[model samples]
Target: MAYFSKHYHNPGTEPGTLVAKSDLGRPVTIHLIDYTEDHLEEVRLANAADCREYLERESKTWIQVNGQADPETLRNLGDLFDLHDLALEDVLNTGQRPKLELYDDQLFIIAAMPFYNGDKLDIVQISLFIGKNYLICLCPLDEDPFEPVRKRMRLANNRRFVTRDIDYLLYALLDLVTDSGFPVLEQFGYQLEEMETDLLENPNQRTLARIHGLKRELLVLRRVLWPQRELLTGLMRTEDPLIHANTQVYFRDCHDHSVQIIELLESFREMATSMLDIYLSSISQRTNETMRVLTIIATIFIPLTFVAGVYGMNFQNPDSPWAMPELGWYFGYPMAWGVMIAIAAGLLWFFKRRGWM
Candidate 1:
């Protein structure tokens, strides 16, 4: 997977400054959904200024901005919604840690949404501005993950969306963001299981590399998921009237999901560590087996070498009694071969009986 680079202004730049970034080349696309219990109107806007007329309506409104917008568009949106300058800057500069900020006019939330792009994990920064009768979402990525929520709102018979206020909508979005990590975690689960199998059968350098790679991915997942639990807790504990009591219950469920994700990450990390240990043990065991076999072969050949050395000294003096008599025997060459074979056979039997083979 490719790494995600953080985008930020210069160190001395103003907090509210909205700088145009070259990395963000996608044109901004704005989609508006305004609805009541029995009415719904969906439209695509060419300019952020067009949202002013819908914001003035009595019905609840949801504005979704996909990709990066120009400075003029961002300023127009900030003026229309009274968005804090610092919050706008954050929206412009992505890669922010998930957090919750209580602004004077709205409840601001920053969340990381995780998804897989063809077997690789990718995260997009999603910023939400929750007002009394409206919800604004800004996503820096091109993919839109909120289509399911939009589809549900279009259904006429679904009371969950029909009977709820903007707060419930905010909860829905939060719940989606919290649960997005499951699929990514599921992919990790499959990879870890395969690694475990390979570790058991026969581990090599590639197995070790796979283990290290998985550990790094898990670390990234943990960084993205750990703060989310606290973010959800902050949302639930806030006394702001923006979030309803009934909707807080849903937020609690979302918090539980975050805790579950974190626990899974910890379990995966432990498994990755243990897999590395298993790989090392396998390599050590193979080396020991090889050394034992080599030692046995050398031990068997030692006595054979001594016999050959004694017979090779051709001291065949007829006057000396102990001058290597085997050298003078008629069957001297065959006799030497028989002696070496016997010695090898005896050694093999001894080793087998001693359970050292």
Candidate 2:
């Protein structure tokens, strides 16, 4: 039920300044994967300089930095690749909304990858700098959503990996990230179904809290997804040379996936709202049933109390004309008892006949 927000920046910091927020303690690691039609090389680079030779080669190079690089290292990278300082700053600063920006020979893209960690949704920001021959992906060290993409590229006979442009690789990464929400949404759907069943059988305070918490999580998901759909649309419509026309067609597919995620999120939100109403209604119905039973019991006892009060009333003397005869007669006491019993039985029969019992 707890949510983590973005970290606040120090006041008066200049724009385009790289700041390390979460992964400051972890040293940055660079992994280079270079591939072409007939050759492939994968290695862990010792430093930024090790990437230079591969960058100059004709092969498509994928430079993946696993941690938030320090300002000096980022500056070196910016100089080496001619990346915009602003884009580098965005990469270091986490919790950016999904967006795409075009720079002078590069396409800057920001994306979010969501994963479930024991019922909690954790989102990681992925920033990409896509150039003609090289692609740089910046992510945290905890998890990599693109591991599948890497595995596909390592396949020896995969013609798609060997013959495709770097833009196709970018599309693959984005597609993976976009489709990641399906599993999370499926989890949500299962939880909601369970909640619905519980509400119908035995609604309680805990159920109410869960519904609210789920609603909040769905809101967070929507915030991440809507803009992502727009980002994909923007990528598909852009005229950037780094994103090929063929690759743009693939972006449309990614956009469709985003749309699907958004639709599911909306459905969950509505279901959560309806669950709240149903919970309230269940409570009210229980209250009404209790009240009805108490009312019936009180109505049945009212006349019985009246009969006992009349019989208990005392006269001035037993010999008086009003009470003496009946008080002295032994049969009078029996007759009075019979009358009271008959009255109670008649009342019970009347209630049964009227279906009030």
Candidate 3:
């Protein structure tokens, strides 16, 4: 994942100019699903223009475009569906902040879908165009996150799921995208617990690095999720006809989920920051402990070194009798050893009594 969208045109480029990403080498695939109360048809098409006939039918049409499309394909989709030029441009340029824009007679929405690709977090931008009888979804990635919704639609015996309107379908898709973060959040939660344990017990540089990485990921999640809450609010409050009153209720639920995810991200950020502080404090504390032990050892040797220095300065002549009387004695060597040991033991005892040991 990049810090920003890698797709952009030159400074003087005109508005609504569609530029396909140079790195987008995969071929675009279109999946068409037409359904009603009791009728259903699903097929894959080789071209975006093939959706024209399906759009004319009485049943609802769902055109799922998977992969980054070229300029020609985007133009074909725009001309066929009467999509706004600006909306098409945004679709071509990925990594848009989540938002809802109203075109002449269509409602356009941009949402970010986050998932874990191995140990890395990646986000895909999904652009949706909601029409009276159709919902066109443009997914930047090839994986289908809407498989669960399709499975629900295919269950003929599911009585509780009776809404056949495209608005309901739109709600389902948004809800899926919003809730996809839960699993990712769960993974983060486990990592946090492990890091917290390490931080409290035996923190190291690796633990601090993990905390920083988590904070960065949480920041990215916040960027993706904060606008989604506002987008959901706009959808519920706006009097867009494409989103029916009944569907607004579902959107409200999805908005609640977005808020929940944001709250989780906020808490995780705080925890990461706290873990960093804990790691620093632990390191400082260990350093202080080591310094104290070294200082005590140096303090204990100070008097012992002074005594050894005095005895080493020897004068064996009678003229130096006043300075070297003990050096010539028979027990002088043992006496010096005893004096050094006594001084060292005394200092240790004093330190223990003063609670500095």
Write the residue-wise lDDT of candidate 3 on 142-214 in tens digits: 7777889888878888633345578888888999999998998999999999999998888888888899889
In model 3, the clashing pairs are none
Candidate 2 has its poorest 10 consecutive residues by lDDT at 1-10
Record all residue pairs in model 2 with backbone atoms less than 3 Å apart, i.e. clashing.
none
- Report lDDT (Cα) of residue 159, candidate 1: 79
lDDT (0 to 1) per candidate: 0.88, 0.84, 0.87
Please report the TM-score between candidate 2 and the true structure.
0.89
For model 3 the TM-score comes to 0.96
Instruction: Give per-residue lDDT, candidate 3, residue 291.
Output: 97
Per-residue lDDT for 118-172 in model 2, tens only?
Answer: 9798777888999989999888754455778999998887878679899899898
Q: Write the per-residue lDDT of candidate 1 for residues 202-260, one digit (tens) a residue.
A: 89889999998889878877887888788999988888889888889999999999999
- Between prediction 1 and prediction 2, which has the larger lDDT? 1
Q: Give model 2's clash tally.
A: 0
Model 1 local distance difference test score: 0.88
Which stretches in model 2 have alpha-carbon errors above 4 Å? 1-4, 22-25, 312-316, 319-357
| TM-score for each predicted model, relative to the true structure | 0.94, 0.89, 0.96
Query: Which candidate achieves the best lDDT against the true structure?
Result: 1
